[model samples]
Target: MPRASRLAVISAATLLVAGLTACSTPAPSAQAEADGDWTPITIEHALGTTTIETKPERVATVNWANHEVPLALGVVPVGMAAANFGDDDSDGLLPWVKEKLDELDAETPVLFDETDGIDFEAVADTQPDVILAAYSGLTQEDYDTLSEIAPVVAYKETAWGTPWREMIELNSEAIGLADEGDALIAELEDEIAATAAKYPSIAGKTAMFLTHVDTADLSEVSFYTTHDTRTMFFEDLGLEFPASIAEASDSTDKFSLTQSAEQADAFGDVDIIVTYGGDDLVAALTADPLLSQMPAVASGSIVNLPGTSPLGTAANPTPLSISWVLDDYASLISQAADKAE
Candidate 1:
């Protein structure tokens, strides 16, 4: 049986694209080699100082959230944890990332599947100089174990709960890619801006980052506030939030909004709602009593996300998915406008 989070509403084509992006080649860069100088560097982490040896060439990453950071900085991992959600054997590499790698002609690296659990022996077998566990639910036990094999970069804070920007910056510095990370983010922002501009209808509209909650309770809902699910992925588009949501958020999280039935409807007045959740959640919405009556759904102004299983935690937090959100959601919004045309 597929995991609850495995349910999705994206098209097959999108899934294929997302999968391809996950395994795509790394950008044009010279292969990293042992530079001899091992310096202790103190880098900011979700927890605290993640002191590790400098310029680790053969790195292994457990979590996929920071996968793009290294790629963005041209530091392809010698190995990455297996794709847990997206492509089973491939690890959670999204097709967008794969495509970008292909664009750069980067080689695909070996992947470690952490689904069963992290394989300490297997990871050590990769002979990785440094290990990155950024954006993961790694326990202290796991941290201790992995550190024995190589310096581990586990969550400094809650798994994906950390800021995407900070994740990018932190991972960049950790992998010696801070400058490139900034450049990648800048380019990504430019891409978001261009795409947001292309979709004139969504501009200045209040949009609620959505997730199809389990249809059990019509009132049971969740949303992406500021610090929620990288919903700020649209900030570059200059998208605005509705007064109701803005009031509710009051500067809470950046990624998601968990609200009641009344709170779900608060997004009713949102100009265009493009939710990011699984098919299970969508199923709940379609069958939901009160949810069906919400203004956005009733008016057909809601654009259900078009990404595959990748849109869940793993997909939303990565750099490539940030762009994928715009592509997937922007197209949906544009199509909505076209249908009216």
Candidate 2:
């Protein structure tokens, strides 16, 4: 949930445009590829099922980080939602995404800005053959509207609930690259496992993911639950979520749980604390009378991640992002774990 609001806006705009463009364009071509006999494939999701009758040439992506899946599989989308964060001077693309596009010599695709809901005209102009939002929090209405323009593949169960591996596999299958998707998953898994092996100190440690709010009374403190991608990232590194956190969590589906300043003592048992904010966040937490009691903060075993930094992007844990931040992220966790030891 590190960048949830940004993601929410992007996804909401995608759904809005899909509705507006439904009646504006002619249906996509029905012709199966003439070069190869592309078999039809059906993908089931939370909203409904979408069957691709042929290999789609123009792919469009909506929602957070779903575009990376297609890019990682060597397919550049015809259009994609613009990233509002972590893009730093590269138009609407993250650095890694731009690098991949350069490697493929592919022109930068059309980027839909979601500052004021869906830009129906822009999305329609791209003329995408298929729209992928398999990691989004789209509603049933959103799916219905999008399906009118082109086949839409939505998240499998809960919106934004698909694991990173499933997101890649589903998107690849949507683009007729299921085998390539499996290979990509295996390769990334190997990379993650290899990175974890380098950080032997991370194993058997109890870690917590939290975010600091710049508030007058420190009222915005939040702790991530097992449902969050950041926690999953730690699990990949062989760290366990502290039992104290599980007992404190209130929502089953949400990624994080909020706590008042008085509850800071709840984090005392956590060996390592991963958080996002500015440099002063550690100081702020330690200054809080209640939070200072926590051992991790007392000993300064806290990792403060910048909101737009590469490690911050890894906190959201997409297929490409995990690779981008693995080495640095692992080293940071190892250093924090060492403090606990």
Candidate 3:
């Protein structure tokens, strides 16, 4: 089934013309036919400003989940980063991605293996008109190199910190489908709200995401901060952030932080602990001299996601993966929250 990969490590628009009526709304599109020339789409991000001069017919996305935007927008990318985590059957395609491709009846595109890093060579081979990495962790050097191949759309603020809605908006705009992106975002927001409402027990409960726990060693605990999209998704699901985590995240821009397990009591405010692991990992956590004392652990309020399955990736929240695993994820969290009660 699922592969053994840690999730903590993983990392379009059309414009319609407005009618003459005052009540008519214009659909989002990057290039409104202006004087027989297309207007360039300019996006500023942490790396640099990316200006897409034309609608990209051959899209190439590097880094995690960037391709999903183009694919969800009905534009198949020429190439994209291969799935390095939660890839069941070792097919390089996550289940949702594969399902989307199958629904479109399109063949799989070239998958750039990002096991080491961005495969510049594989990306360049695609000869793409534009590159999308709106939710990526691309360094300045990586941005510069990728730009040489095509116009690169990168994360606007922090690396791997872009929310799913923004990721869709930026990536879709680069492809001249801004309006469509907005609609897609609305759809997902509604879906999330409806699904979360079904799990009332999780509402207002504080949660923390532990990143890739090492069962053999409980000396330290590493967790995602508010800056990471995974933590941000808690707000989307009606979950609150533990005040301790918020305070710890205040001084750094990093997506993750680690502290000695001896300080586990600091996280007593956390009502639920969500992390990638199995029963043994849970056993290990509960058995730990320090960690076992944390309220979540002592109360059995931890949600252990399987690291090897597509469902494990659901905590991070992606466009396609939401519908695929939202109910299960929410149910688990709600159950854990109930335990806290």
Candidate 4:
């Protein structure tokens, strides 16, 4: 079952070469390490500080799009978490990830199925030199278990709250490609800016992403709080968080929070709403007296993304998926923004 929090659903991919000029350059740190000289690098994170004593050759990534960091920097993981949501195909790989593998002319690596939980035995069998989960929600126990397998890079701050830039920076640096990671960040920033520029309507609009709304249960509302990467991506797309969301998020470290539907008026300031569902979900929202009274719902300023499609994963930007999904995602948001009252 798909977790209610977008943070729980993992996604990945690689960017097109034409759009990634930075990827063409050889990373200086990687080149130096290739010559048998590796400088020790220590990283501080919410879990604990991890030090990389030597260059890692067999990199493995657990949880979410951590694999995209290495794949974006021209390093394929020996193993990584299999796609659990928005896969589109039953191959356990998202489309962009599959495309990256094909572009690299390499076969699929060992995919650790994470439906139940972290498959420690499967991750151990990969024999990874390091495990990356800079954007994951790994618990202390998961971290300790994985640490026994290899050096682990967990989230820097709140779990699943690591922005795309930091995710790339931390993961790439771990693999001795810090410079390349910086380049990747610059390229993506430019990409986001350029795409956002095309949808001026979405610019400055206050937006909020609703989690999987139970159309059957209209008594409560669940949403991604500011700590979530999906909410963070709003800024990347030139969207502002409604003051209500910011205020609600200010008090909690949790990535998601629920409020009674009777209090749905709190989101009146939101100009556009994005959520994972279909037409029926939208109808349900508009039909509800409390929800329909909200400006966005009454004005039809909502983006109901199909949860099962590759496009459904667009809200949570990653190194690779941004280039692939930004245009369509922005267009949807822009259209919704135009309807804002």
Q: Cα lDDT for residue 221, model 4?
A: 89
lDDT of 4 by residue, 1-341 (tens): 43333212221101221124245445877667564877888998899989987688889999999999999877889999999999877898888898898899888999999998887767766767789999998999788767766789999988778999999999999999999999999999998999999999988999998986999998998999988888999999999999999999999989899999999999989999999999999999999999999899999999989988889886788988999999999999999998983
For candidate 2, the per-residue lDDT at 201 reads 91
Model 3 alpha-carbon miss at residue 268, Å: 1.2
Q: Per-prediction TM-score, please?
A: 0.73, 0.87, 0.88, 0.89
Q: Assess the local accuracy of residue 277 in candidate 3 as a C-alpha lDDT between 0 and 100.
A: 87
Best by lDDT: 4
Once all C-alphas are superposed, what RMSD does model 4 give against the true structure? 8.9
lDDT of 2 by residue, 1-341 (tens): 33456445545665665676565544544332342668888988889889997578889887788889889988899888887777767488877788888988999889988665444445555667788888887778667666655788998887667788889889999898889999999998899899999999999899998864663668557888887666877787899878888776544777777887787777778999998887678878788888778888888888878877656766778878778888998898889988888
Residue-level lDDT for 195 in candidate 4 = 94
Point out where model 3 deviates above 4 Å: 1-37
lDDT of each: 0.63, 0.79, 0.86, 0.87
| Backbone collisions counted per model | 40, 0, 10, 0
Q: Order the candidates by TM-score, highest first.
A: 4, 3, 2, 1
Q: How do the residues 36-113 of candidate 3 rate in per-residue lDDT, one tens digit apiece? A: 355778898888888877657789999889899888989999999989998978999999999999999999999999
The digit string of per-residue lDDT tens for model 1 on 140-245 reads 7677666656677766566666556667776776776677888887887788778878888766666666665555655677776765544665555566767777
User: Where is model 4 more than 4 Å wrong at Cα?
Assistant: 1-35
Top candidate (TM-score): 4
